[model samples]
Target chain A: MDIDMSLVDWSRAQFALTAMYHWIFVPLTLGMTFMIAIMETIYVRTGKEEWKRITKFWGKLFGINFAIGVATGIILEFEFGTNWSNYSWFVGDIFGAPLAIEGIMAFFMESTFIAIMFFGWNKVSKKFHLTSTWLVAIGANLSALWILVANAWMQSPVGTVFNPDMARNEMVNFWEVLFSPVAINKFLHTISNGYVVSAIFIIGVSAWFLLKKRNIVFAKKSILVAATFGLVTSIFLALTGDGSAYEVAQKQPMKLAAMEGLYDGKTEAGLVVVGALTPGKEAGDDKDAYIFKIEVPKMLSWLGYRSGDAFVPGVNDLVYGNEEQGLISAEEKIERGKVAVQTLTEYKTAKDEGDMETLAQLSPLFDRETSEGQEFYENYFRYFGYGYLNAPGDIIPNVPMVFYSFHIMVGLGFFFILFFFLVLWFTVKNKIDSKKWLLRLSLLTMPLAFIASQAGWIVAEVGRQPWVIQDLMPTVAAVTRLDASAVQLTFVLFAIIFTTLLVAEISIMVKAIKTGPKENEGGK
Target chain B: MNRRNIFARVLFFYVDGFRNLSGWGKKLWIIILLKGIVIFVLMKLLFFPNVLNQNYDTDAERSNHVLETLTKSK
Candidate 1:
């Protein structure tokens, strides 16, 4: 079959573009909802008009961001059907469940409480209003949790079985899929990053007020809350990020190798601190990929494998296979994947011809308790996506892109931690207002935070290229067989629509921020 | 009788609410609408073809092809 590479590329671009746009608003909503809740909680506890003003002020911004987030988010969910109809049918049974649950359980919860939190200020009791705000925060994070669980399943397809009759993966054990270590770690890490984004936003906006010498008391109090929250979550982000890397090393060694720009397998690989890539470096080029490199000694192995001298397979090792590193070649995996595919086809043909005996024989291949089943799935079925590839080099992701994005994200992450620490310290020392340089720096952090967040996503999504669901289906096979032009056209359309909405959102938010918090307008 | 009274009358009755917008505002609003229509309505109607529905007449056909792709050795 002739695969439409253009269709696959456009479909991927469309999805990635929508996902990125959706994320810009989502992280803010996720982080700021809780910040607003915390502020409202203080308002309830202290009964201070000042605290109430801060809560109301941030609450207004949250509402603006949330409205646009909802709009962008709905498009992403629908794109699974519109842009990737094949992916929808292929993994819909298992994938759709979590998404549906997110909608029914989490989205509704968030939207409902948000209404009450915003509009019920004067209507509800103080304690009740605070409860509603907290509920909204919980609801938003719970939404993230379910969606990330779905995404992690794609990254590490667990507790699911391929049914040839349905031509799809079906969940046998919901618990395993929901509670997979990948899902849990991703949820924690992603939401923590959201917290960081929110803290940065709060600090940046407050810094603007400080620079202008307007709303000094309000800005100082906000800085105190945001700084503390940012510091705590930034630490969690680091820890969870470590867990995420470990999971990637275990499940997707190719992705890890690409991220580090590692070409040769090593016993104890140093994690790259910074590196410059040689131009026009191909995956199989004899020359070194990195022109000049700086790395932390033995850190990659220690971080990825919890050992100082663990064997880590590089891109070349994965492509060529390294017996010493216990790495199998992509060629071998592809061969096995073909066999798995052939067997399934034969199984289907037999079933079509009413061959019950053949069905009985094929049944053991899927049976978890059987040794033969375990060997077949663990060896061959696990690398089923390789069956669709034409060359072993197709297994290599864009190394330079992944490597740079990873470094940028990590660098910004550490920078944020230090920034938050300084801000918090200054706030405690009563020198926050006087530190004009720090205030200006904080104001600059908002865009930097956004860039870091986008880069992190690019690493995760682009680093796992060619596979919509890792090792199960290549993106070529997963896309809807549409006219490429049709997809390209719609891609442009969505881009325009989303951009326009984003501009409107920004304009309204800036106007609101410029109008300082009202005094004595408690609840009303 | 007054300018404010006349402005309110036009705002309440006009289709584009031109009285509510300045001269530049009217032009910008029209451009935004035109762009929105071209993108959301015209492009979707013309270019958003249903490839899946066209290629496979039935779910069984699509499923069979997918299964074959997975199982057929390259």
Candidate 2:
């Protein structure tokens, strides 16, 4: 069976692009739904017409976001079977459980309540209707939670065991996997980030309204609520981001190395903020032959190990020679390096080698029985013939996407702190409405918050690069073999449908915002 | 107490509690349910699988066994 590597690459690329685009709307739905619930509950409690107006306004937006989220999400599920058939088969048992539960428990609860929340306003009592809204919010967040759990499992697989008999991985205990450290931390970080995204979204839109002097009463109140939420969440996010980085360093050293663009182990590594990593170069170079260059400071160790003097391996260290001067024999170390190099070469060659015997030997060694061998092989393979092999003992992360994304996310985090603080200061001093420029800037910053949240997630997921589940399974090995054409067709179809849904959502939201909530004819 | 009197007393307590809850507690409860129970439980179930005891050593091995079982059944 001849498999075209281009086709797989194309399909995978399409899938990632589509999923990412779809995800832009998902966290908003999850976070905004909760915010809407809060707004509506406030209305129900205070019986203030203003709160009701706020509730109705945000509810409309949530509805639109939710629809787009659902539409885009459905496409991803199909892609797994169609594009990654082998992956489905490989981790289906462990992977299928969470997805099934998500569908049956979380999806069902969320969808059912969402319908009630949307259409039940007139039919149900105020209390029942409010309850429905709360349920819908619960449902949406639950959906995110379940999906993250599945992703987290992929990030840090737990409670599973190797079955030499079955020649694959299988679930051993469901409980152990659920409570894995990675899953718990990732879940908190993701949901909190979602909240931050929604808060920024609210602040941005409200600031725009204030700048325009439209719905001043509602906009002021909305901004107050949103800014408060955004400020707090941003602070939380900064802390969580730190913790997540620490975890990444511990579990995914390669990803950490990639993020910092470290080519050699050093006592103190500088954190590169915004720099181009030219794939095959030394730290200091002036020409095209310069491979990987990054800004340096000892910040990597400070962040990852919490000590400036901590030793962090660079790409070269991981690939080449990094042993105690006399701890191990030189011959043995070279042999180890050779084995690692051979494994990586075999895997890559098998993709294009067309030799069955060589592939057979290479493939099984990458299996559970010899994953250590696979890792060593991959590290060496990365060093050999890559033109950037001069500092072979360094560890390089396949994380160009993550490195930039992380910085962008962190940069935005600080931006929000300043933006919200200024808004709060102005508002308290009764000068918020008087300052049109600040209002406009605040309004514009909302999308930036959402962007930061999305980018943060991208870094978290993409940084894990080669592993689907940390050290347990490599993504390449997890993929299923289905016709690439099928994946392409589905991807195109989804792209069209999702775009339409997004357009419709925006139109509806625009109409709702323009119309505003109707004034109560007679105080009910 | 007489049935009428008992009903009246119960109604008074219910209205009083409702009024208090309507101010802020209701809103807080809703937020908690949405963020805490719904999202937390779902994410836990999906992203983090329940790892039962098995004879295998690695997650990949266990995953393969499960897949084989499912395939065999299919």
Candidate 3:
């Protein structure tokens, strides 16, 4: 079959660009919603007039972020049919389940409660409104949870069966898919990251207000709430980041290798803290084509396997080498690789020919040969595919947009940990106002928080290149055969509409923030 | 009761019950919708024995047996 790599690349690029744009507001929506809920809860508990001021102040920002998020998110769903028709068809059986649930369950719940929470402020009692706010927060996070489950299924594919006849994967056991180790870890890690992003967002905005001396009471209270949440979420991010890296090490060694820029497996893999990764003949040569690199201690192994001695596959090993480097016979490795290639080839052929019998027989063969018992063989085969399909060894996750975005996100995360702690310390000493520089810095950090959140999403989505569902279907092969002109038209239309909405949202938010809370507004 | 008084009483009960019961009702509604759509789609698409026979071949017979068991259990 003939393949148009350019079309696939173009479609992927479009999707990645769209998704990155959409995600800029998502984390803020997730984090700010919860923070606003907390403020409202405080208002409910203590009947604090100041707390109510804080809630109303932040809730305005939350509403802006939520509106933008909703507007951007709808484009992504439409693109499934418009851009990725084939992918939608291939994994529609499994993928559609979670998405349908997301729309029917989470989206409706969130949108419904959000309206009640936003508009019912004067009409409803404080307790009822507060409950609605909490539900909105839950609905947003729950939306993330189910989507992650579906995504993690694509990543690890648990509780699913390969229907050789159907030419697709099917959910055989829903529980297994839901409880897959990778999904659970990813769920925690992703939600915690959202928390971090949101907390940083609040802190940044609150800091801005403090610096401006516009709404001192609201700013101080908001920053205090944000800092407390930020500090706790930072801790969770660090821990779950570790867990996620460990899972990646176990499941997707290639991704871990790409992230760390590890070229070869070594006894003590140096963690690249920050450095340029230049493409050249020699590793140490400083040339014009310098790539980013940063080196830390034996943190890679420690993070990957919880032990320094653990061997994590470097990019070079996975991409260039076939042998396991110990105990595995070269002949056996070659034989196993041949069998896998044969199985995959036959499976595809059988699928194409609509020969269910041959397809079914080939499915278990690949599965058995790829499981734990066949690690040595499986590793070599995978390495071979990695080399053949994605060569140059070092050019993986080649999307500069994804790579830099991931780095920026991680960098911002570290920045917030320090920033929040500093704010917390100053607030404790009652010298927050005096530390005007810190306040200014916090204000400046708001856009960075949004950028980081957006970047994190870019990395997650773009890093899983080629596959809409890993190993099952290539993303390019999954796209609908629509004329590029049609997509271009829709893209232009969406861009205009989205831009208008964003401008309006920002204007409204700016006005609300400038207004401050009304004195007799009572508890928010 | 007078018309106004009766109307007020009904409104009070509706609002009171709605505030208290809305949360649980929302959750239940979500669960029902998720299950209903999935079951309906699955039945429409795959429940037909002829479609299964055409699609799965030898596996179709086994799947049919399983489907029978599933329906019996229900």
Candidate 4:
């Protein structure tokens, strides 16, 4: 049972590469569908041909994103079976449900109605066509729901039972998995980010049109719609984001600790407003964690636990154990986890050897249905991933990476809220054209939104370091045993393919926007 | 199939719609088609395989192997 460290690294790199590229298209699809649907709704209500033109114009762009998103998304799904087959087998019973539902239900609904939205304009009645458009929006967001639910389950790992005979977690209650607070918050926060991204994208392109003075009426209308949408969703994004962070504190304190670069426990933790980390800082080290910093007093405690004085354990506290805080050291957890592993192995060996008496004795330890078994599971099996760790330091994820990413994401979240408000104000006052600097500044939010979105994911995924399924499994063990070279080759292959596709997409998008929306038939 | 049939009419509607796509629509669609073929058909067939399903034909084998994975020492 020798582990290939290189294989794990390469496999992780490949999956991360595919996911980041796939995401570039997904958020747009998630939010743009709704925006387009709104425009089409307006068209039906007012019999305004211009609104229909706007819908069609955005729909074309949506079609472009939707296609590529499907392509990358398919690769990402298959990577589960390819790179993480073991993890798949472990949680696929639970994870597969949402994913399968996404494909069978949401995806089919989207694909079926998408054609009508595109080509059935004349064939279908206006109301039916509008319904199809709205359905596409709903379908796209629904797809995000199931995928995020699967992701949330990994972060929280609830509502599942360990089947001793099968040696994998199985879903015992679908409702717990679906409506878990973590899942709901993640889904809402993620889709709201999408809405903001779409709003920013539309506003940015529309601003460009205004700057060029090419599509005066079209651009102003677009900005009005997008700015209003952006402002509302940005507020919702912040609320859901708060809930997401609270869940992180409750479920993954280590991640929360890393995100804040906190190395010691604090009863009333101040959230870092901005900070520069001292390089080479590690858990339990005397090195100053931050070289310079600013923080809001007690904000972390309030955000994490909904109280000003709730104790928040940091990296050192979590690793070395905080006795006063009732935190167990990783060293102790590792010992218990090792016992869990060893006993399970002995049970399997005993069963294999037809030793029925030994099996009878060990069976109760693995059974959650019984009281003693529940105790074993809670006290030992819960830390099973720690059994594979070489040292307590292995429990600490890359702190600087998590700390910086979290800061950047929060900074931009506030900025976008302000930016959207100003954009909408300028639009309402009919001063958008006169504010050259503001229009230029508005263009920058699109790229900023992308960075903020990517940073949020970095905090979520990278902060959860070492574990693929929280405490249940470490990523090193979850990765498939494969030749490192094979994974390396595919990584390069995907990089090339995705880059080429992105370049082409940008070029096409630019060309379409420059061409402007199709004029009304015969100029109305 | 009769031209008057609903299915035939629906099929013709899409066929005609796609065939008459404007130049930009047609180009975006071409990229989609090329990407779909490469990602779904070529990439999946060549680069990726379901290791668990490919190697083990039965659930018993999979369960045993996974059980061994969980308990085995590095």
Candidate with best TM-score = 4
RMSD in Å for all candidates: 6.9, 10.6, 8.9, 1.7
Q: Considering chain A alone, what is the TM-score of candidate 3?
A: 0.85
Clashes of each: 1, 63, 15, 0
Write down the TM-score of every candidate. Answer: 0.90, 0.73, 0.77, 0.97
Spell out the clash pairs found in candidate 4: none
Better of 2 and 3 by lDDT: 3
> Which sections of candidate 1 miss by over 4 Å?
A355-360, B1-62, B68-74
Evaluated on chain A only, model 2 obtains a TM-score of 0.81
Query: By DockQ, who's the top model here?
Result: 4
Interface RMSD of each: 6.4, 13.5, 15.1, 2.0
Question: What is candidate 1's lDDT per residue for A35-117, written digit by digit as tens?
Answer: 99898888889988889999988987886676555646656655676677767778956778888888887657754576567
Candidate 1 reaches a DockQ of 0.14
Tell me the tens digit of each residue's lDDT in model 4 across A57-158: 888888877765666787877888888988898885788888889888665775579888887787889999999999999988888899999999999998
Please tell me which predicted candidate would have the highest lDDT against the true structure.
Answer: 4
How much lDDT does each candidate structure score?
0.83, 0.63, 0.64, 0.88
lDDT of 1 at A210: 94
| Docking model 4 quality class | medium
lDDT of 3 at A487: 54
Give the alpha carbon lDDT tens digit for every residue of A259-373 in model 3. Answer: 6556566766767667665554232233432265656777788989888877877655554453664433323434444444455556666765789898666556445334642
Q: What is the interface RMSD of candidate 1, in Å?
A: 6.4
Error of 2 at A492 (Å): 3.3
